[model samples]
Target chain A: MQKADALVPVSAYVARAALGRLAAEGSVKVSETEPDWAALVIRVRDHGDTQAFAALFRHFAPRVKAFLMKSGAGAALAEECAQDVMATLWQKAHLFDPARASVATWVFTIARNRRIDTLRKARRPEPEDLPWGPEPEPDQADAFELAEDTRRLGEALAQLPEKQRALIERAYFGDLSHTEIAAETGLPLGTIKSRIRLALDRLRQSMT
Target chain B: MTIRHHLTDALLMAYSAGQLPEAFSLVAATHISLCDECRARLSAFDAVGGTLIEDCDPAAMDEDSLTATLARLTGAPARPRQVDRPARGLFPAPLRDYVGGDLAAVKWRPVGLGVRQAILPTAPGGVARLLYIPAGQAVPDHGHRGTELTLVLQGAFRDESDRFGPGDLEVADQGVEHTPVAEADADCICLAATDAPLRFNSLLPRLAQPFLRM
Candidate 1:
């Protein structure tokens, strides 16, 4: 079988998470509300829960700001972008489907796309379909699976070989394409692609 | 349809990071809608993106930013969003938004050799179009000057590399060259995007390129 074909069963994933190396930290952790963030966001939407919204903002805003800064945004612009992301969350809270996306994925996707939108000087109308795109069929990552996957992602990422992990950050966060990464790092295109593929395999193995 | 061809991890990562042009992202998004596996994997990539954000060196924000955001929230009523669920048809949500309607509504202009095309208006310099090929028909043999994402929305097509069925996305670049022929059973409809013009091998196709605007 190809290396990429080694997708683990859910039991293996559970075993991996139970080992504690799999629980990754992030911007927010809901101690009182715990894992059901979809419900928490729903509370923010239905009842206008200030506490939940505030909690989300406090944890994510600084990180979103930092994210934009990494993508070469000025401090002032990054802050504005971060604020826009938070406002979008509040405004679009009803669209949060926990089954389809973890809170971390949903928030960061907003941050990533917002960075691009702000960078574009022209203000064009975005199609009804937002950046996250559509999720029609049921995904394999159920809420329980997503909770485990999100908790474990950081740990799995941390365990990657230094070079692989760094490349992943550049690819996912720095907004660099594989070819661009090769150019920046002075690595061959083939080398960068293979390293990233291997890194993703490890992440999938460790995440699953 | 069993999806055999898929966007490479590198391509998928580029799409997730917004490094790809809008045209490439549009094709990726449309294929992702129909392929549950790709959607699931993309979610993982998105989560990874979120983790990277948390790990960045903290950038200080405006002290009054939180105060401002909070103050604005109280005045702004909760905006309920009506998600536009694309009707179950040949066109998915992303494609529907560009086409402005269902598949039959497409205004296809001839692209020679029984192939029809409707170029969707997107950001300048990035070209995305819908292709219709009758069964057993073939796209002119060609390579790409830049990246091309060909997503099969209906039926199947085969190139030099492999066969692609519904929900399969073929990511092509300059180094790859092949003729993609639709399967015999049904006509093929694909959403394709290319950043640069194609490199057709034949003299006639190459000569006609300026006219096709491909």
Candidate 2:
């Protein structure tokens, strides 16, 4: 683990509030009208809520499949791998730290590791997990802020000029090696990097 | 120990994108295990991937995709969270996974001049190894053809470029050439990875290079 900061004190009050929300909406549905992904993951984590898992699967599975295909997997393999990624997601929901990563970000990591296994037949070494303390849930404000930051980052990525955006996409989509990425000239990655950097600082502060 | 040296954004981004060779990924993971700055930077890069996935054009799944996936989830349960262990030993978790234990478990082979190395298994394209340099001994003068990552784990070393202490990572490429000597205070143990064979400047090491598998 990295540096230990002040612990996030467990709050039974917040825990009951979360359970209250889950109880109030006895049968949740996947809808454009309600897309609180972190809350939905909490529902899945606390109670094995199939409705919430179904909603997450509906939203992320196809995107994961598309992500795999872009990395050069055939459609069938991509579909199979995407399902595995989602299954791993459900199995690892307790490990998801909404204060640290968006659900989309967490899903990307799962899909990326799956691609490494199925496509390249290689291992992906990961950093040690931070000890996130006894609380599985985070401060609601922290989770909400992280989601907002993720949304803003998506918009920023979309607004980049065509060439810059394409280069960035190519870098993430396995089109560029580290050497090529290092030698890439005039990349417009500075602004995007700073935006994400700020989000990380906020996350670190919230963890403290 | 505080780490002064860190991985470049290029390497971190490539790692975040899952594009590095296995050897390079191993070095990066070990360094991130020891360095928080790089860890935070890596998370930011992962955010970039997240954004890309979010904005990508959606491909429709088969009609039964969600149902099929739900059925697969039937007997699944959340993985039990790892028990929080206090950081206890020299090796971080990632390296421990490869070595299967801490410092006492490494199987070392003598290279020459009181230096030993142990190569870890990884997919081809690069090689990852642990190098042991006795206190006050120097590795042969050499240069690299491709990228080389050397991370200090147990002791300290210095070259013409800079001093690398525990958790410090030195990323050397084609233009960097130097001899690294272990500090006299203690024996130095490092985890090093190279993409291409090193170009030893002297005849003896050059001849021994093939057997060294460096």
- lDDT tens digits, residue span B132-214, model 1: 99999998653457777899998999877789998888878766767899999999999998874523234544675697543
Q: Which clashing pairs does model 2 show?
A: none
TM-score of every candidate relative to the true structure: 0.73, 0.82
Task: Give DockQ for candidates 1 onward, in order.
Answer: 0.19, 0.29
Docking class of 1: incorrect
* DockQ of the two-chain complex in candidate 2: 0.29
Model 1 spans > 4 angstroms off: A1-42, A121-145, A178-208, B74-87, B197-214
Relative to the unseen true structure, what is the C-alpha lDDT of residue B56 in candidate 2, on a scale of 0 to 100? 69
Q: A152-179 in candidate 1: lDDT tens per residue?
A: 6666767777887788777866656544
Q: TM-score of chain B only, all predictions?
A: 0.83, 0.87
Error of 2 at B91 (Å): 1.1
The lDDT of model 2 is 0.77
Docking class of 2: acceptable
How would you encode candidate 2's per-residue C-alpha lDDT over A1-208 as one tens digit per residue?
Answer: 1111111111332343365467669754333454778787777776766666766776788899899899998899988998899888877878887776788898899999998888777899998776654454566776676677677777777787888878878888888877777524243344444544554555456667
